[model samples]
Target chain A: SQQGEEDPQALSIQEGENATMNCSYKTSINNLQWYRQNSGRGLVHLILIRSNEREKHSGRLRVTLDTSKKSSSLLITASRAADTASYFCAVGTSYGKLTFGQGTILTVHP
Target chain B: GAGVSQSPSNKVTEKGKDVELRCDPISGHTALYWYRQSLGQGLEFLIYFQGNSAPDKSGLPSDRFSAERTGGSVSTLTIQRTQQEDSAVYLCASSQGFGGAEKLFFGSGTQLSVL
Candidate 1:
């Protein structure tokens, strides 16, 4: 079963705009990580935010986690055409398994 | 290899046929994971191996699916009597340690098509 659920199943924006994706999970987690998949192939690790920490950033990607609400969000600033891909949020539990959510497809038009 | 490597970037097999997918994780990495992603669907956890410890096979969907990691390095996932529902991209990933808090490096994955 999937642990996380991402909102806004699809998003379309113009270049230089910002895109935001949200995810909600069912249970407590040790950490949460975001990944990007291009062409429905391999997924690349984007950023990871521990349960103890509220936010993390990598390049233009920003991730925020809220344990109380059991949700997280990913924000891509100044989106580019290269940013078009499927974004997924995975929840890492105590058992060492990372369960992914139904990803949000973001399309950045140039 | 600098990153995880999977064999036969694409495979097409007939129903009831058996297929083996191989994954070679990065050198020195101890954790390996298998996941299945259907078209337009979230990834489904298949299995996980960490060092010499017993593998976690709770995520496997059926007895037809089995996997093994040899020498704590290369891993293979075998599916017997393939079904159309089994057609999906099988992804292999490896991490330096256990995955609860570590990032995983992924391979391009094998696109399996069962007819």
Candidate 2:
């Protein structure tokens, strides 16, 4: 079953611009994680924010979680053409299970 | 393994036939997961295994689908009497342990096409 739902199904932006994507899920979670998939290949783990954490950052990525609203957002600073890919948000559950979202396709034009 | 690995990057089978996909997760990772992704659709959870615990198979769509993880490492996903709807990419992932909120390392996945 899918719990997370990413908003802005698709986004197109130019290089150097900051791209932001959002995700919403139903029900409680232990943590929320973000991944990147290039073309149709495997997903690369980007970042993870625990339920207690309001925000976290790694490299050019920033993730914010709000348990009250059941929503999370991912921001990419200085978007690059190489960053063109589909971003997914997953809600972590017990026993190593994770419910994923439909994902947001970000296209960074060089 | 350095990373999660999947076999037969691509497989095409006819309807009514059975197909098996394999995944070799990173060593020492006790958490394994299988997910299906249809074209232009979000990942659909299939099953998950945590260490020595019994697997969680609640997300399986039908009886035709089943999976097994041997030796707490290599995992296999089998589909019986395949259908066109089963055509999708099967992804495998593994984490350090169960319920750690740890990151998942994903395999390239097997592109299964049922004709």
Best by TM-score: 1
TM-score of chain A of each: 0.97, 0.96
- DockQ, candidate 1, comes to 0.85
Instruction: List, residue by residue over A54-98, the lDDT tens digit for candidate 2.
Output: 999999999999999999999999999999999999999654579
Q: Rate the local accuracy (lDDT) of all candidates.
A: 0.93, 0.92
- TM-score (0 to 1) of chain B, per candidate? 0.98, 0.97
lDDT by residue for model 1 (B35-76), tens: 999999988889999899899998899999999999999999
Using DockQ as the measure, the top candidate is 1
- lDDT per residue as tens, model 2, B1-115: 7899999899999999999999999999999999999987888989989988999998899999999999999999999999999999999999986643799999999999998
Q: What is the TM-score of each candidate against the true structure?
A: 0.98, 0.97
Candidate 2 chain B least-lDDT 10 residues: B95-104
Task: Estimate the overall C-alpha local distance difference test score of candidate 1.
Answer: 0.93
